[model samples]
Each structure stands twice: as C-alpha cells, then as structure tokens.
Target chain A: MFWNKEIETLSRKKLEELQIDRLKKTVKKVYDKVPFYKNKFMETGIKPQDIQSLKDVTKLPFTTNDDLRANFPDGLVAVPKGQIIRLHTSSGTTGKPKALFFSKKDVDVAADQMARCLIMSGMTSEDILQNMMTYGLFTGALVMHYGAEKVGCLVIPAGPGNSERQISLMQDFGTTTLHITPSYALYLADIMESMGIDPIKDLKLKRAFVGSEPYTEETRKKIEALYDIDVYNSYGLSEMNGPGVGFECGEKHGMHLWEDNYLVEIIDPQTLLPVKEEGQVGELVLTSLNREAMPLLRYRTRDITSIIPGKCPCGRTHRRINRITGRSDDMFIIRGVNVFPQQIERILMSTQRVGKNYQIVLDALDDITVRVEISKDMFDGNMEHLVDLQKEITGKLKAEILVTPKVELLEPGSLPSFEGKAKRVIDKRKL
Target chain B: MDAIKQISIFARNNPGQIERITHILAEQKINILAITIASSGEFGVIKFLVDQCEKAYECLKSEGMTVSLNDVLAIKLTDKPGGLYKVAKILRERKVNIDNAYMFVQESRKQGYLMIEVKDINKSMELLKGEKLQYLKKKDCYPRTKKPVKSSQSGK
Candidate 1:
C-alpha cells in the first residue's frame, strides 16, 4: 500500500546512497540551468562531482530565505515559464513575497508525496476531508486538496474563517479528516463550544493534519481533548512543494521525513555545523530531491527542530524529525534571556480567559511590554478582575521566562486578526 | 430625560483620523450637532450627536471605520454660566454617575443641548426630572423623526 514502497522503506545505507545520487543530479541541474546556483558554486569552488557522498553535502552553499526573497518573482525557476504550471507565494508578512514555481511533473510528484502522507496518517478512501486552510496563492489548501483527491477522498474545499459554516459543512458532509493549522483548529474548537455543539458527539472528524506554525505540547493536548481527534503534525515549506515534506506516523512520535523526496539536515544556526547527536535542537535545512521546475539545494528552512533517531514501530524506514520548536530567525533576546514568541504564546494559551491574539512589543525600553487580549467574557466584570489577570499573566511569564514583564489586558478583538501567520511580536527597537 | 442617539467612533489616535471621518460626514452634508473626543495612548473614541445617526453610522461603517450607535443621555442645558454646574451638582448629590457628556448650542446661541452617558440611565433621568430640566427630544436635534413630543413647552 506504500505510494513508493522501495523508497519509503529504504535502509539507512541505501537511503544515503539515494540522497547522494539525487543531490548530485540537483546540483548539476541547477548549476547548468540556474545562474544563481552556478555563481554560488563558482564562488564556493564546489563542483557537482565534488559531492561524492552525502557527507560532502556540507561543502555546498546554503540557499537562504534572503536569497529566495532577493531573487523575488520568477528569478529562481530553472525551467521555462511555460513548463511551470503552478506558483505559490510566501505569506510575506514583513517583506516582499517569494515565489515558488512548480512544473506539471513537480505538481504530480508533490501530489504523490502528499497522498502517501495522508495514507500513512490514517486517511481512507471513504473519509471526507475538509481542507480549511485559506486557498489562493497559499500552498496549504491546494496541495492537500490534490493529495486527498489522490487518496479518493470526497474533498470539501472549505476555506478559512466562517467557523459556523465550517462546522455545518462538517456535519452536513460527515467529514472525517481536516487539513488546517493548529491555531485555526483550536479556534474552531472554541467556536464549537460556543455554539453548544460537542464535536465528539456531533462530528465525524477522526484525525487532523496540523502545521505551518510552531505550537506547544499544551496546544496539542488541548486540541486533542477539545475535538476528541488525533492531531498529526505535517511539515513543509513553499520552496519544497508545501505541506508534504514530512509526516507523523500512527506511532504519534516524530514525523518521518520522506528521505527519497528530500535530504534533511539539522544544523547549529550560529556554527552552521550539523548536529551529530540525534534529538539535539537545531535549524532544519532541506534539499529537494525530486522537484523539477525549481530545484533548491541546501535551502535553509529556518525551522528549529531535532532529528529523532531510532526506528519507528510503524515500520517506515524514513528518518523521523521532532516537532518544530521555533524558527531560528524568530528568536529575540530580552534582558539577556532568549525568548521565543511561541513560548509566550504557550503560556498565554494555557491560562484561562486569554483570547487568540497577543502582542509583544520591544521598543526603546529594553524590557518587553506584552498586550494580551482578554476574552470577551472576562471584560464584563469589575476592573479588579483585569488587574488580577494582568498580575496572573505577569507572574506566569516571570515563572516561564525568568523575567518580570509588563502585561496589559486589552479588550478582545482590539488587535489585528491575522488570516495567515499571526504577527505577535513587533521589535520596534529596530523601527 | 430623553436619551438622544449618540454614535461613538473608535479610531486610531493618529493624525488625520478625526479629519478623515469629519470629511466623510461633510461630504454627505451630515451636520455634527455635538461632539466630544476622548483618547488613551494610540487609540481614541469620538462620540457625536449628528443630524442623522443611522445615516452617519452606516456611511462611516461602509467606509470601513469602527463606529457604533448608542442611545445616550441628551438633555438641554440652560444657556447660562452655571447651567451645566447646576445639573452636575444635583446629579453628584444623588450619586447619579455620568460616564461622559458634551454640550453644544445651535447658531441662535439662546439654547444649548448636552449629550451624556450615565452609569444608570433611569436613575439619572429620575433624579434630574424634578429640576424642570429641559430635555431635548430627538426631533429637536434630528427634525426628521415622526414621534410627537407631549409638550413643546418642556424646552422651558
């Protein structure tokens, strides 16, 4: 039943051999077809033949986030424009959007990879999957749509927002699986509770695929408890065909990276050296093996995660990766303490009456001022309730980050609602 | 005391925001009968008693501004030096809290009206009724409604 039986179950020795072969082909193809890769290769003095083994991959130059953005639209496509059939743009929350091109062959291979991910994550032909990720230039919706269709799922292309309609569609269609982000899933759970609908009793959702942002273990547990469904972590990026790179197995442990499709590496962001010890946290770097329209080699994904060493009881030989902790670029130091926004988010979410949005502003003052939106229900009480909440959040933050922070309780919906990635932190010190 | 419809507009406390909304209302020939602005840091609230409450709220909302309409307290103030102080003194004695208030006189300058929001609407109205306070009905300011007032002489 494996989509690519031989590739998925390849032994470690054989998998590395396959990775080396694909890495050589990708390096050579990009060097000949794309000028950017060629110039980088010339500057680094590394030829395609120089990569004799997978270990030699360290010699290759890393294609980074800035490089992709600098090239912007249509700069990195190795194939002709006519050959490229689809394009997905990065969220570009802060700067210019980076374009990702996919040829028809690339699309098919991505679909195949996604289909394999779905089957492995307990999707069946009889299951009706509602793809709730926002559609259009966003890659989450369409990639999952094609993959679920490949698995013969009756797909409900319900885009994001309109939580009532999402729940209605679930009840009407008897949807069994969903493709959505972790935040949206929790948001939907909240909506369900407000609507007096018990999801476990009213819906048929058996499992979900949650990713595109780093979430905490608490959120995972809360979402699972809320919906009574198993949540599987799915990881991918726009540069690497989106949302099908690695997937969690039935073991509910680490996600197994599709080694035949991508060569994965965990490296220290500062030293840029691979972490030899498995399960050590580092930035995840990936090289697409099968992508044709745009072959990105040694592309720095910036996602922080660890390599989960050891065998999966699911019998899949593909190497596993731990859940993404945070982005390497997303970390900020406050009062000499390296604080991640996700860490703040985890603390905020675990507390009661906290809304879906919070803003951490680091300005001229060295300390951070966090404005947390108190859910609507809490605002009806006296001002003391808010002062207590502020104290509670401040105390928890101090306990979590080891620094006392200035916390303000804002009314719900005071801050901007993000349709894609939530922009929770604003480092105004730069501004 | 009559509660006149007052619309509160929530706008970012940035330059050109008040000018922006006033311009939009001016384009529609909507007269701002009374206005008061309150601000806290980067955002503020502007409450107005306009000629057309529904029209102004709809147009502003259609233009994508966060605006709301509430029937707040509106009463006529004697066009004299201690008129507002007298009303405030009586209300303070009764512990009738007024959340916010604004007053304006028409071009005639002989009569003025005050728009206010109180902690308890019924309590404030009851305590201020025996003062022979002149409460401005919505029609006095709007002139577009069909409701008839019990006494035209009540604007005493």
Candidate 2:
C-alpha cells in the first residue's frame, strides 16, 4: 500500500488541497459506517459533501474526551469487533478509560508512522533500541517496539523500572538507542553516577528519544549533560495511535507531524476557531488520515502548541509543531487566577540553590494560598542564603503567576521522591 | 510516667478543620496539651499529645479520619537553634531515618520537646536511651500541669 507521499512533502497550498480531499473521504467513510459520526452530522445538518475542503472542517462537530467516554468500550468503534486487531486506552483518571480500536491496516499505518518517528530521531537498522516505557495497558513500550522492528532495528522490549537490569542490558547488549521518559532517564543517570559508571563512556548510547510527559528545558539540559546523549522529544497520545504520531528531527527545531497519516490544526482554545497568526499558541486538533477501526475527526487534543511552516533541515516534507508548553486541563484556577504547575517548576529551577524537587500546596485559608516546598541541596551552604532564595522565588512567582507563593526550603532529601512522574502540585483548596 | 500512646491524624489542610478536631477532643473531655502541625500544601499530619491517648484516638477515628497510633520519641532539648541539628546528627550517626517529626516548646522549662517519628522505632528508642536524651512519655507531659484531675474525678 502506498502512503500519501505528495501530501507528506507538499507545499502549504497543495497540502491543504490534499487534506481537504482526505478529510472529505474520511467524513464520508465515518458517515456511512460510524453511527456516532453519522448522527452528529445529521444533528448538525451538515452533509459530507459540504465538507469538501479543510476550511469547511469546522462545519463538522468537534469530538471530545466526553464523547469518547460516553461511547465507552465499543460504542465508538467504526469497524466490527472481529475486524479490530488491537486496543489502546487512556489512564482514565477522570473517569472510565477511553478505549480505542485498531484494525490490522490501522496498526500497520501506526507502525509506519512510528518508524518515521524513529528515523527522524536518527535511528538505523544497525542500532539496538532499548524500549524502557511501561508495557501492556500503556502503549509507549509496545508501540516503540513495533515501530523499531518496522525500521529494521534490533528491539529489546525492556519495559520501565528495574534500573539495574536496564543498565546491565545497556552495557552487555551494546544498546545504542534508548526509548524512555526523560525523568526515568535522569533517574538512570543518577544511578549510573552513584555506581561510578559513566553512561556516556560506559554505554554506547547515542540517541535518546524522550516523551510520555511534558518536560522543561532545564530538565532536558540536565538529562543531556548526564549522559552526553542527543535527546529528541517524541509526541503522541494513546488516542492518536501512541508515540509515533510526530517526532523531532536532527535539527531539533520542532516535532514533524506525520501529515500523511494525520491532518493537524491549531485552533483558538476558547473560541474553537482557527488561529490566524504565526507563533500564537492554540489547542491541537487532529484528524486521522489513515485510521480504520476508529478514525478521529477534529478531535481536540487539549495540548497547547504552535505550528511552524517551512522546510525542515532533515528534508522531510511533513509540517513541524512547537513543543507542547502545557496542557489545558493542567491549568488550575486559584482565587480567580490561572496557574500551571510547569510555570512554578520553571521559576523554581531558575532560582539559585533549589533542586527540581518541589511541590505546590494550595490551602484554603479564607482565600487560597499557594505554598511551595523546595528540597534544598546539602552542598549549598549558608542557611541564611535560603531566606534570600525564598524571597527571590516569591518575587518571581508573584511576577510570573501573579501571586505571592509561600516558599519553604526543606532540608536536603526531605521531600518525597518518585521513580515515575513527580507529583509537583497538590491542590488542597478544594477541601 | 506510664507509657502513653500518641496518635498522628492526617487531615486535609484547611481552616476551621483543626478547630473542629480540637472541639471533638474538648467535647470528649480529652485534654490536648501539646500539638504541632507539620503541613505541606493542603494536607499535613497533626501530631497530638493528649491526657487520654486512647480516648483521643477513638474520637478522631470515629470522626472518619485516617489516624495512626505511632511511637515517637518526645525528647527535651535545650531551646537553642543547634538543638535540632544535634538530634539530627545523632540519628544520622545511628543510621536511623526520621520519616516525619514535629516539635513544641514549654515556656516554663525553656526547653523544646521534639516528637520524632523514625522508620526504625526500636533502633531510635535504643539510640535515644543509649545517648541519654531526656525522652518523656506522652502522658508525663500531657496538659503541662495537673489541673485536669477535677474533671477526671467529677466524671462529668
């Protein structure tokens, strides 16, 4: 089967033309087979023929997380259960997990997209890729495994945790590429340093593909410095067919969306209209170009990002997207003020003598007050300096987030440490 | 001094919640003499030293709060800045990790009593005893005075 090669490398005008054609076809397909889409179309009184181009995409109703949750298990699946070969799901922290189905053809297309991601990150068939993501219900490990195999690379299905074994495999098997979250990689680097094993010198690792959670630039630098490995950020969701939907090339400018397999749009989050300006951040809305069992149309990702046009240094025709800054859901309002945990993290990391170990505590004291507990580094002497550090952090926080956060410098190693995503924000104001 | 139980209650950090807890104890006539709130964000564990430890635990538990009866070393140290550091250094040398801790000072004695909850209770007690740290039982320091006898005797 041939992919949309022209659309992948097409000019903006021609790419839009191709997208309009595919979107029309996708809408028609969903209208014919998928009851959910057909009903939505009928209710909106918009015919599939009317959606002849990308501009007319807004004519169709927007798909949401609630829609997926409402449909539940097989309610949203376009193909029959017998036709579906694989299933993936979100964590379902909010409620019941949103399940997605994939036909054999759909799985192949996803694998191809993943292969493209690996290639973008400079992976070769000669390279042995060590997948350190969580397996089973989580799609990171398995999808990367399939995609690496598709790229003709030697795949080692080493799921997350078990750092000793991961290091051993890296040393013994001569693993050259690593697929894991950025935080876990840092944890591995910390362990390697404590063991006096220089990951840069001891292991033959060259490229590190990091994702599964949003990361900061400082954290990225720390990881790169620890292993001396070139880090490329990968972006995808279980809803969008796992960690191969888009990836960063060698230029490291932005993640190149596999436009052939997905049509992407950046829309004003509040207005739900197309963002007209360049460099303006908006919500990412994706339409699956070649999904079979469950193709999504205008599905709001809720991830804030900007689109970058022009040719990439890697010569791939696919469009690039700026790194996702933060999630719309992660933004919490306190005292009629908006706050993102990432902004607090950024401020804390920028401060002197403060490690990345910090947590935001929102307490209800008549009005909401934000308390930030920062883990102190033992090496940074002068306890009095911490008072000044706290002042500086409070000042910066008040300036950036527009609130004077109560900053507490805890004793070294006093705060809880996590092997997984660090719990940075604790909202106690709800009580 | 009899061996008195100390209970740690984890509650969401909020205003008036602590007052509600104190009110429950007051209603049950369980006099809480010493308490320290070590809070981070909206949640923190409130460590209490009450006259009737069992009654206090029952009161808090009946209120549907997750309360744990823990063995903590209530040691009296000189009310100075380095007093905490000395205790921390001793624990470090003994290889005992302090999971959580809190402190309160008696105005009359001019000394700070720290309630340290360590991972290894036996090791911590042994170390404190071996080092001759002035450790006191919870009831020995309950109420800081013997004024609650009339209420206990009246049984009202």
Candidate 3:
C-alpha cells in the first residue's frame, strides 16, 4: 500500500547509510558549482572530504536567511541556469526576497516524496483531490498539485477563496481530499454554516493537508470538528522545495519529515549548537540531501519545534518532528500571508490622516482587523469622510500586505499608549 | 414631507450586540423611536430612529462604533386594517420599491407610522407625494403624551 515501501520502511542503519552517501554528494556538488557554499567551506577550512559520516555535518557552515539575502538571486544555484525549471521566492521583511530554484529532477523527486506522504495519509488513486491553495509563485500549490496528479487522482485545481463556488464544486465532483490552509478551512466552514451545508452530511471530504502557516493542535481540532475530517499537519519552506518535505501519517502522531531527502537537526537559537536530547524544542535546521537546483547546507528554518522521542507505530524509520510551536522572529501569518509589524507601521506612518497609534488585531476566525486612530483634524464629524478614510487605509494596506484586512477608524488616543515597545499586534486567535 | 434621519451601525452578527447599542442609547437618555436589523451572514446593519438623532449618532461615534446616518420615509398610516395595504397599493401602482419597511404604532393616539427604506429616498418621496400621503417629520416621530386632568385626579 505504500508509495515506496522499500525506502519508507528501511532499517535505521540502511537509512543512515543512504543519508551519508547523499550528503557527501550534495556537499561536493555545492562546493564545486556554487561559489557561495564553496567560499563558506573555504572560510571554515572544511572541504567536502571533511564530511564523512552524518555526525561530521556540523563542520560545514549553517545557511541562514541573511546568507540567502546576501546571495540574492541565483548565487546559490548548484546547476546550470538552463537546468532550472521553476523558481519560488520566500518573502522577507526588508530587501530582496530569497529565490529558490528547482530543476526537473528536483521537481520529480518532490512529487515522489509528496506521493509517499499522501499514500501514508491513506490517499489512493481512486480519490478525488480538490486543491484549494493559491497556485502562483508560491510553491505550496504546484507541488501538491503534481503529487496528487502523480497518484492518478481526479484533480480539481480550485484555487483559494470563493466559498460558494467551492461548495458547488465539492457537491458536483464529490471532492474527497483537500489541500488548504487552516485559516481558510475554518473560513470555508463558516461560509458552509451560513449556507446550511453540513460538512459530514453534505460534502464527501475525507481529509485535508493543512500547512503554510504554523498552527496549534487546538486549531487543528477545531478544523477537524468543523469539517468532520482529519487534517494532517505538513511542514515545508521554499528553500526545501515546498511542502512534500514532511507530513503526518495516518497515525496522526507527528509529522514524519522525509529524512531520506532532508537531513534535519534541532539547534538552540542562542547557542547555535545542536540539541542532543530528543523532544527538546529548538530551531529547525535542514540540509537538502538530494536537491540539484539549489542544495542548502544546514539551512536555518527559524521555526521552533522538536523531534519526537519514541518510534512511530507506522513502521516507518523516518523520525517525526512535533507540531511547530513558534517562530524565532516576530513575523506573523494571516490568511496564509506572511506579514510583519514593521510593514504595517511603514504603511500607517506614510499614509496621510493616520494618527500616531495603530493596532493589528487578529481574531478567532483568522481575520485581521486593523484598528487605526484617526488624526484629530481628520475626524470632521462626517460619516462619509470617515468611511472613505477607512476604505483608503484598507486599500493601501491590502496593496502592501496582499490580503484585504478589515479597517476600523477610532477616535484620537483610543488605542493605549505604550511606554517602551509599542505592542502593535494583539493576537486574539485561540491558536 | 420631511424624511426621518435614521442611524445605522455596522456590527458583527452575534448575541448582546443589540443590547450593547440599546444600552448606550439608554445611558445617554436617547429614546429609540423605531428600530430594525438586517443581517447578511456574519455581520449585520442595525438601523435606528432616535428621539435625539444627532446626539445618539455622536455618542455612538465617540464610542468607536461604525455608525452612519441615512434618510428613510416615515409615512403616516391609517392606524387600522388596510392601512399598510393602501400604501402598498400606491407604491405598486407607482412602481416605487421598498428595500426595507417597519411600523411603529402609538395605540393611545391611534396613530401608526410606516418606515420605508427605498433606493432613492427623494424619488420615492416625490412619487408618493401626489398619492394623498402625509409624511412624518423628524420631530413628529415621538409619541404625544397628554397632561393629566386635575378634576379626574381629584375624583379618584
């Protein structure tokens, strides 16, 4: 029943051996082709020969987002420019976004891993998959789209939003699986509730793969309760060739990060040293073992999570990583869009008629409500003027953040003034 | 033929919201002459015709509520059967559509008032003017109270 039973259930010894072999090849390839990794290797005085077993991987330098930023466009690409088939950029708060390149082989391997993940989650070729993720420069959608297609599923590339149409498609096509963000899944549930469409009785939804944002188990349960389906937690980033990297099996314990493709290490953020003990929370560091386009060496994810201690009952030797707890940075995600508080501040400060104080409040439904105080002179005691001002602010914020947020105008000095650090965000989400 | 000014507030559709609005008005000693709520899924619009409309609007605004003011036709009814039917017949004959309508009846005075929110308040007003309809001004929305007679009190 497994997509690749031999690789999935390989013994620990054989898996480690495969990992070491792939690691040595990846280190040599990067050192030979990409000057960024080669220079780092030279600076550390560690050659490709320095890496022997999996434990010696620490000698190589760790790659951070800053390093990616320094080498902006294609400095880290390991293959020739003609070999790159796809490119995805990870958003940053300032400066140019970090670009990731993938070759045809890399794409195929990603889809293969995705197929393994889906098969582990009990998906079969007979299933109908309705992918709800946005398909664009973002890698989340296209990768899963390829994976489900590889499984011979009747794939409906129904992109995100438009709840009524989504429901009709589900009703007409009998969609069996979904790939959606947790927030959008909850939002669709609300829409279904208002339209009197019961999930269990009306739709044929069996399960979902929720990712692209860090969510708590409580939020997962709420989604499961609302949709009457199991939601598997997925972990991936653009540097790792998008989401087929790690996924929860049918056991629903933890996400089994595909160790065959990725060498994962948990390190303390302060010490920058690997956490020796399992089940201890730390920042996730991943190295691409099989990627050809742009293989990153010990790439720091900035995501905080831990490796599960015990063996999974699924008979797979790949270790599982716990659900992501928090981020090492202050950036927050809403509606699957990465947003920074500084970005909001930049918009509010530049916009005319905006007061000195503004607050970004995230509600339980994963909706963002930006509470902005109107300047003293701007509040002219006219409802039309106030409404127009609110609309203008919303348009500006949406243009910057790529997601429309509900804007609320308040009286001057309505928001509390902070002494030192102004807490710009008030997250009321139960998650 | 003055149209009544109504205050409308945009709020999340949840319990205790109407209570919150009414409590604010009650604390300000502003009486609600007429009220109606229209919900479109998660959020709804709460409309109100208050005794002191400007004061209530300003108060709600100061409380950081998303409130707006609009004009609604306040047609005086016949205070009996076929009262609304008469208006409806005239509206239908003239092709004047009502987006929303609610009634407020003062039993003591045998006076009935019908509030109709139309697409174009002035156009509807002009169309209904020649239909022998009397419109209630803003001040006329309040119920009239009679002074107690001294002779009746002494006899009692």
- Candidate 2 runs further than 4 Å off: A1-8, A309-311, A331-431, B1-156
Local error of candidate 2 at residue A110 (angstroms) = 0.9
Looking at model 2 chain A, report the run of 10 residues with the lowest lDDT sum.
A375-384
lDDT (Cα, tens digit) per residue for candidate 3, span A184-302: 99899989989999998999999999987766577899999888898998988989989978889988998898898999899866667887688766789999999999999999998
Model 3's CAPRI class is incorrect
Q: Candidates sorted by DockQ, descending order?
A: 3, 1, 2
Top DockQ hit: 3
**Can you write out model 3's per-residue Cα lDDT over B1-156, one digit (the tens) per residue?**
888888887665689889999999899777887788876544456889887776777777777676777788888898878988998899899889987788887657588888888888888877877788877864466432133212221112
Error of 3 at A289 (Å): 0.2
Docking class for model 1 is: incorrect
Evaluated on chain B only, what is the TM-score of candidate 3? 0.85
Clashing pairs in 2: B13-B42
- Candidate 1 lDDT over A1-431, as tens digits, reads 46667777888889888888888898889999989989999998889889888888899899988899888887788988899899898876678888999999998888989999998987889999998888899788899999988999999999888898999999999998988888899888888998999999999989988876777677788888888899888888888998888888888798888988898888867678997577766789999988899989889988887788789888889989987867888877787766667668778988897787999999777789888776644333223344567789999999877878888766456789987667878898887
Query: Which candidate do you rate higher for TM-score, 1 or 3?
Result: 1
